[model samples]
Target: MGGAPERADGCGARVRGRSAGSGRLSVTARTRGWRDRAAAELAAAALATREETVGDVLVVGDRTGVLARALGDRGAAVHRWGRRLGEGEVVSAWPPDGTVVLSAVRLPRSRAELAFAVHAAAARTRPGGTIAVYGANDEGIRSADRALAAVAENVTTLRVGGHCRVVAGRRSEAHADGGPDVFAIDFELSADDWGSQRLRGCGGRYRTWPGVFGGAGLDAGTRALVRVMAGFDRSPERVLDFGCGWGPLARAARALWPDARVEALDVDALAVRAVAANAPGVEARLGDRVEGAACYDLIVANPPYHDGKEEDTRVIEALFSDGAGALREGGCMVLVVQRRLPVPRLAAARFRRARPLADEGIYRVWELVGPL
Candidate 1:
C-alpha cells in the first residue's frame, strides 16, 4: 500500500515494488508523495537543530524508497526495510553513515525484515540519537507510535499534509526492555456483492487486497470501458491489453479477435494472476515490459487513473508511451479513460493522431494512429 508518488519532479518514470502476495506494491504518486513529504519534514526537523545531529538514521516500512531517495537528495546515508528485501535493495545496497530507514507502512510481514530494520537502526544510531517512524493515519501510524513509545518514551508526532504524520522518537536499550512484540493478524474475508454482479467473494477468491484498485469487482470506469469493448476493432493479429485488470478486456478482446494473440499486462501482479485464473487462455504478465519489441499490431487499455490515495495519470501515460513504442509503424492503440484526465493531450503528442470514439463526461474512448 505504500511507495513513492508519481512524478512530482516530472520524471515520468514510476518505481514499482512486488505485488501484495510479494509483500510489496507499485510505487505510485499517491503513496510516494506522502512519504516524500514526511521524510523531508523529518529530515528538516533533525537538521533544524544542530545539537540533535546523530551519527546515523534509519527509515522503516514501504516508504523506505522515498526516504532513501529524499535523504540521498539531501546527502544523508540511508537504509530501508520491508516484508521483502527487494523493497529495500536500492537503498540498502548503498549504505550511508547518517542512515535513514523508513518503517511507515504496515510493519514487515516477516519477522526477519522487522528485526533487520529495528536492529539496524539501534546499531547505527548513537545513544541519544534520533529514530523516526512515519505512517499515514489509515495505515498504522498510531500503532507504530505505540511501538516506538516502548523504545523511546518521548514520542512526538509532526503533522504532514494529506492527513499524514511523521513520528520522531529516541531509541535506547532501556526502551527495548518493555517493547511490544510484533505479531501478524489473520482473519477470513466474507463479502456479498450487494451492487450489480453477484460474484460472492471468499478467502483467496475475493479481490480486496491492499492497494489493488477495484479488487472487489468491476469498477464503474472499468465497467464503462467494458461497455465499449464490443465496438473495438479486434481484427489485428497481435494484440495487447495494457493494464488488463482481472482479464475482462483481454477475454473479450480475444473472443472478438479469435485469431489474434492476446496478451494482458498489468503492473499489479494480482491483476495478472486474476486474468490468468478467469481467462486461462490469455497470457498475463506482471509489471510494465514491452515484450516482442515493436511487434504488436494493436494495443488496447482501460488504463488506471487512480491509485488508492490519489489520482495519478502517470500510469496511463506510461502505458500509452510504451504501447506506442511496441506497436508496428502502422499499428493502432485504443485507450479508454475519463474525459477530464488529460489523456487526450498526452495521446495527441505521442501518436500521429488521436480521435474520439465515444464520450460520456466521465469516460471517453480514443483511437490513435498506428498501421491499419
Candidate 2:
C-alpha cells in the first residue's frame, strides 16, 4: 500500500500496488453490485464503437477499471483521470489534446459540473475526435448530451443497455474555449445567524467551478453547525476542516480567530481549487482521506453520504475512526450532520464522549472530545 493503489481486472486484490504503465498487472478491487453492472454496459458500448477512430483514450469518473481495460483491449492507449485518479491509470499533469475522452458520469451532479466535463473534454479533443459519456438513465445521460452539444457536434446515442446509455459527440472546429469562465456558476447564500451565508449574490464572487459538495451554497446542517461552533468560548489555535466544501467553516474559523492556522481539505479537485482561490490563508489539499491529520485543536466536518446513487457511511465512519488519533489532549472534532444520521452514536462509539452542542431544524452539531 504505497505510491498509489490500482484495482486489477477482478478479485479485489489491493495489497500490492503497481506504477501506471509498467506493463505490470495489479490486482484491482472486485467490481460488484451496481458498479459491476454499469462497467459491463459501458465496456460493451465502448467495444461496439467503430463510427470514429480512437487513437488515445482518456477516461474520467468512476467504474474506470473495466472501461479502461476495455478501451485498452481495443488497442488505444488509455489514460484515466478524474476524482478517482490513483487506480492504475497513466496519471497526467494535464490531459492531452486530440484524444478521445470517455467519462463515466454519475446521474446526480450540478449543471456546472456537467458543463465543465463537456468543456474540458472539448478543450482536449481535436476536431473530428470524439467524447463519450456513459451513465444510467436515472443519471440524466440524455440531458447531459444537450450540454455536450454546446461544446461538440454530432451528439447522439452511442449505445443503450439496461437502464444505462452512452452518449458520444465529436468536437468540432467551431468550438474554441475563450477561457475557463464558461464553466463558472453563481452561488447566492443568505445569512441567518448561521455562518456568513457563504455566498451573498449572483455576481460570481464565489470561486466554485463544479461538482463540489455544498459549493452551490451553505448547507442547512452546516450552517446550524457553524452557529453553535461560533458560540463556543475557547479560541482554537490550529483548525482542520475535514471534508471542507468551499472553505466555509475554515474561512469562518479564520475570521473568528485571525491568529488561528486554518487548513481545508477535500476529495474534490474543484473544491480544493475553490478554497485556494477564495479563502486566502488556509492550506488546501486534494485527497481522499485524512491520514496524518495530527494535533489539531478543532476539526470540523460535514462529510458526504453518497457516492453517486449508492448510500453509505464509510467515509463518516473513517473520519470518526481517525479522530481518536488525530487530535490533541483537549482538542475537538465538530461534525454537522442531518438529524437522521447516526453520527452522534458513531462518535460516542469512537471517543467514549459525544456532546450534542446544537440541534436546529433538520441539522445537528455534535462535538466529540478527543482522548488525552
Candidate 3:
C-alpha cells in the first residue's frame, strides 16, 4: 500500500497498479494459462515491474511473442525483432538509430550473441533510454549485468521470478553507433582442413555474424561432409544446402560443381544474411522447409540436433522428411550428424536406400538415395 497500489481484475488476475506520475504499469500479474516456467513470461513481468515508463519499446529475440503482447497491452508502442512481426506492424532489420526508448532482449545462449544483441539494442536506443536483458538463471542470466555494462550504465536488477531474472541499464551515448559489424567475424577454411584444393582455390575466406552456428570456426562435422562431397563421382545440376549455417556447405557445393545452381536455406535470419555475404551468388532462403518439391538434384545438410539448450533429434528428422520430398528421381541427399545420434535409423525410415558415406570418429556422414 505504501508503494504502488495493486488491484485484481474481473478475471481474477492480480494486476499491479501503475504509478500516477509515470503512467507505467509497475508489474503485470500472472494471468490464467500463463506458464511461470517460461522465460518469456518472467521477462514480461520484469519489464512491467521496472520503475520507468515503457515508450516506443523494441523487443528482441522474442520467439514466443509474449513480451511484445504484454507491453502492447500496457499501452506501450511495441516494435519487434528476431521473429516475424504481425501484419500491419513495422518490420525492419533493426530500428533506426536513437529512435527507441526501451529495448527488451531475450538473452541468447552464446556470449558472442549476447554482445551482438546488447550492442544493437544500445545503438537503437536514445541516449539515456533503458535496455532490459532477461533470461532463465540457468541459461547464464547472471552474467547479463556485465554484458550490459559494455554499452550501458547504472546497470541493476529489475525483477526476479520463475527461476529467471531481468537486468536493466541506461544506454550510453558513447556506444550509440554500434551495429552488427561490431561482432562480425572473418575466418578462412584451410585447404588441408577442407580436403579440397579446389574449394580452397574458390576462396576460403568467410564471414559470420554472431549467434550463427559454426560462426567461430568450421565445425568438424561440416568439414567431413565437404570431404565426402568432394568424392562424389557425379556432378549435381541443382543443389540445396538444407539448414545451411553461414553457407559453408553451399559454398563448398558451389566450388565443387561450378555450373550447378546452388541454394542455401536456413531458418535464422542472421544465417540467411551470412550466406548472402559469405557465399555470393548462392541463393539464400529463410524458412524451415524446402520449396518446389522434386526440384533439387542434390540436397546436402548437416542438420541441427539441438533446439536451444536441449538436444532434440526432431529438428533433423523433420529436415530429413522435407529433404526427401524435395529430391528428384536418382537424386541423393547427404547428411553429417554426430555419431551419438541414430542417423542410420532415422535416415532408413525416410529414405529407400541409406548408406554410410564416411565415419570420422565423432561425426558420421550418410548418403541416402531414393526418397521413400
Judged by TM-score, which candidate is best?
Answer: 3
Candidate that would win on lDDT: 3
Better of 2 and 3 by TM-score: 3
| TM-score-better candidate, 1 vs 3 | 3
Minimum summed lDDT over a 10-residue window in model 2 is located at 9-18
Q: Give me the displacement of residue 140 in model 1, in angstroms.
A: 8.8
Cα displacement (Å) at residue 190, model 3: 2.5
My TM-score estimates for the predictions, one after another, are 0.55, 0.82, 0.84
Model 2 C-alpha lDDT per residue in residues 1-372, reported as the tens digit of each score: 013344331210112233245552321222224744574466456553653325665665534366766666677666555542333333222233444534333333556677776666666666777767766777676677888788778888867777777777777788775444555555644444344443222123456666667756777887787777677788888888877777778767776777998878675556776787667898876544454445678888888766556666777887787666677768888888877887767776668578788887888788888653
Candidate 2: what lDDT?
Answer: 0.62
Q: Please give, for residues 1-372, the per-residue lDDT of candidate 1 as tens digits.
A: 123322211111123443123433443312345544554455444433433322233454443344455555565444443322234432221123342333222243233333334544544455556666554556555555665554454778744555456666666646332111122111233333212122122113432223333444655565555556555544688778877765656766665667778888665544655666655577766445343446777777877666435677766666666567678767888777888777557776567788877775677777788422
Q: Candidate 3, residues 1-372: lDDT per residue as tens digits?
A: 012233432211222322122342211111111222377788788785554445778877665567778888887777666521121122223444447788888887788888888887787787898998988888899898999999899999988887788899999878856456666788876667667766666456778877676765678898899888888888899998877888888988888999999988665656877888878889875455554567788988888776556666765776676677778888988889888888768877778988888888799898888688
Ordered by TM-score, highest first, the candidates read: 3, 2, 1
